[model samples]
Target: MRNNTGPYFIGNNTCMFSCWAPEKQKVTLRIVSPKERDIPMEKDDMGYFHVNVADIPPGAEYYFMLEGEKELLPDPASNFQPHGVHGASAVVNHHTFPWEDAAWKSIPLEDIVLYELHIGTFTEEGTFDAVIPRLDDLISTGINAIEIMPVAQFSGERNWGYDGVFLYAPHVTYGGPEGLKRLVNACHQKGIAVYLDVVYNHVGPEGNVLHRYAPYFTSRYKIPWGDAMNMDDRWADGVRDYISNNPLYWFEYYHIDGLRVDAIHTLYDSSAVSIWELINQKVKSLRETLGRPLYLIAESDLNSPRVTQQPIIGGMGFDAQWLDDFHHALYTLADSRGKRRYEDYGSMHQLAKAYTDGFVLSGEFVKFRKRRFGRSSAGVGGNHFVAFTQNHDQVGNRVKGERLSLLVDFERLKLVAGALFTAPYIPLLFMGEEYAEEAPFLFFCDHQNPELINATREGRKKEFADFRDEGEPADPFDRNTFLQCKLNWLARRQGRHAIMLRWYSELISLRKEHPALRSYNKDNIQAEVIEPGMLVIHRKSKDKNKVMVFLNFAEHDTTYRVPAGNVLWKKLIDSRDARWNTENIASAFLPSEITETNFVTVPAICIAIYTGAQ
Candidate 1:
């Protein structure tokens, strides 16, 4: 299996172009840059056509011509699509980048506080270089890792990036390969790790020319996306290499520390070696050679069979996974406006169960699904799961793309952030969630086809009908839809927004600095419902340090007795600390410790943290 199948510079100003078209009788390499030169490609026995040509330097644009085809096709694995996805592929020399991150070593997965952001809406410039100046603010917020939404080339500029067609190319509008490399290098130098989100289940429908070149998709398995990939179908072996090489390309060329593989549930492979497993094995070998941490986090729920286990254990060997159950349970309680699938989550007890047990619905019957779902993840390490209250899917996929900050009160927002940080899993924050930005992260795209645009709008409205009281869901084709998602960075420095940012920063700091909060051992943590809309999470460190976090989701004050008849418990922080938020000023003067006899009245809709040596 080849690790590459694109234009590669073999010598100075000399390049070799490779294409996989076993069925084609005559495969021609048509270089359209510097000078129009058409070189008839010689096919090897293995179905790959290769030819080395001189004078084809970097930035040279090219396409492949198949026998009897009226139009030429871009390389299946083009590294740089200078124009849009339909444009000719530009040659990019991987060796040209002068990287200076030699001393860069990413932090452990267990210790990461991931901040997920979309490139188009992350800054006004909407380019990779624009994110460089914001690195300081991210680090100061206690984020060690930033997970970028997919930047793969799609139709036009604005997209959530799930519809990416060219797997290897970075979005041209986002400044392409060099821009991404510069961003990665800058992040590594600043002690920040960059993780890229990769979509491999299926390629985007528009500008997708893989069908013209080879058997890239199959109809054997049912998948939500138009066509399932040909992982276990004809030419499956070649397809595996093509899909597997994507992660390696990012790591080797762009210096990405991790990959968040999007939607593995759709990667259906009935072969002896599943495509997901094959990818894990390849990445593991690459990690060994590089002698660095390279995490593969699946965008699948814990229900997917053996997703986080090692290959030796008859598993897919993903390092971690995104657990949506935590988000559902917490979001349902905080925002009663949730619909459809959220009907399964309402009780605070479920959120508590999600905290203690890795999956609340573990092997249990799900009312929403009308069947048993999710094997028990009770034994899984908390580090094996990434938990958050909201992510891109939760926010951007909404009919209106309303952020959690907009749905809940200011105090409840603080409460949820505390819950996320203190929970026994790696925490993630969506862009501008730290400051509670008023702007929504709406679903958007800039597809060139008017027919596809009309279809997309209709499909979105139908999608919302399943779970929401539908008005016309935001008009995705509107340029305003894309522009509205841009983050208000200035808002972060003003009034309540600044306070919320500080609140998030402080919570993240405590999660990092405090021993009890840092430990991801679910066994050392106890999450229980104190009463309706009230919860308490007690954590103990291996070093005998103890912390108890009280979360009150109710709008009214609730009195509770400390379970442990404490001699002395040091109050570390309160979400409603009047000094920071300027609310509940009278209650801020409470003592350092309180016994079980003294009924502690937790402020309405507040989060309070306490610590003591156990």
Candidate 2:
């Protein structure tokens, strides 16, 4: 089957247009460019309407007229929407751009330290080109992979990119296709990989004309936004092909290194050969052909190890998955009153279990869902799970969109960062977190439809009704709400922010330098709750190098006995030191040695790292 389903140039001046509309009896290619003409398309055996027209130049706009309708519709697989989603689709020659990353190969998944950022709020300009100048700063901070929020064309200029309509086109407001290519090429040139977030659960409600083209949606299952994609129903081949080929298109044309698929749990596919497996097969083939490592990370809520298991074992082959259990455990432990869905995770035991087992609710009863959730990930490697202290949903879904910097003190924030970086799994840091930016990442959008605008406003208010005491949520439709989310890049070198940035950079450097810190083998790591609000983790590498991390989450200074049998332990990092800040000086002048007969003093809400050989 021909995988190129969009408009492509056959020669210099001729363009070939193809679309899958099995239900439409007659389809017409309406050219609205240099000359206006309607040409009838011939149907192939595979329910595709295609035609090769002569004298059609690049950058010409066109649309598909279905069933003799006077009103035309944009192509379902538009490569570049020069206007918005409702506007005409423009023909773009894919081979026109000059790429410079000829020898660029993505780093391995285990070695990746992902930094997630939304393009609209990441910079003042909020364009792809704006991100290029900041690449050196991120590289200096030890970030090797940048997981960008979705750029797929949505209804308006500003959105989280979750409610995207056109999956193939980049948002024009963010400089469109060429802008994205430039960013990816620049990242590769600096030894950084780019991973784009993609939404495949359901299309956006506004300007989504997929249902009009073919049976792209099914009534059997409905998502929170709309009907689920028709991945396993009758006449679903074209829909499946379209959805699966999107990542390949990005990797081939845009040169993206990986994809972070949004909400894979909502993709209800009951086929014998699941859509995920098919996508994995295709990606595997592409990896061999391209001779580069490409990754597929799933944002899955289901704690099934099969999500990252190999395809030969009756599993959906994915490289890694977002592990929310660690975040919930850490959040609930840090702030007892800040419970949204963390009903079952307030104890230090849960945090310890999350560190060692990778999941807190592995076949355990979950009070929030009133059922036993998650299966055991006993044999799963830790690199297959990506853990984070904060991400887009954790901050944006809150009533006030408050970041960790606002919820906890600098000491506790450093403690959490210490735990995250030392844990077995791969670590991901949200943008502005390393330097502790105070800007809130609120949920904002610019929907043209009044109904959608009202629905979004009311939906956010009702979603956090229980947290009314935190104050009323900001109006998502307001322009100020979007502007408030932009990061203050100039604040990184200021007081306290500069200290936090140095601490984070040092932590990342330590994690990368020590093989024991980056080892993902759960069996080689051990975690134990030493006291009421203190936990100690021991990570061991194959070379017999051991690093121990002590975390204190209490309100006062405490002393814990060190388990250094015969080896002398040296202090690596202390969050409460005077160099980091002067506010917490309980352990500022404490001794760095850890003796078997003596106890070490740990300040309130602080973390200390020690290295020794076992």
Per lDDT, the best of the predicted structures is: 2
The lDDT values for all models are 0.86, 0.88
Candidate 1 lDDT over 1-614, as tens digits, reads: 23446767765888888888878889998889979988999888878889889987889999999999869788889989998888899888888799999888788898888999999999999999999999999998888899999999999989999999999999999999999999999999999999999999988878999988888888888687777899998887778878988888888889999999999888888888788778888888888888898999998844754899887777888998998989988888777776455777788888888888777787777888898888878788889999998899999887778898888888788888988988889899899998888899999998888889888988898888875654568888899989999999999998888888888899888888899998878888888777767898889888888898888888777777777545457788887667557453545333567654567888788888888763
Work out the TM-score per prediction. Answer: 0.97, 0.98
Local accuracy of candidate 2 as per-residue lDDT tens digits, 282-326 = 888888888898899999989899899888898889999999999
Model 1 alpha-carbon drift over 4 Å, by segment:
1-4, 339-341, 466-470, 565-567, 582-590, 596-598
Backbone clashes in model 1, listed as residue pairs: none
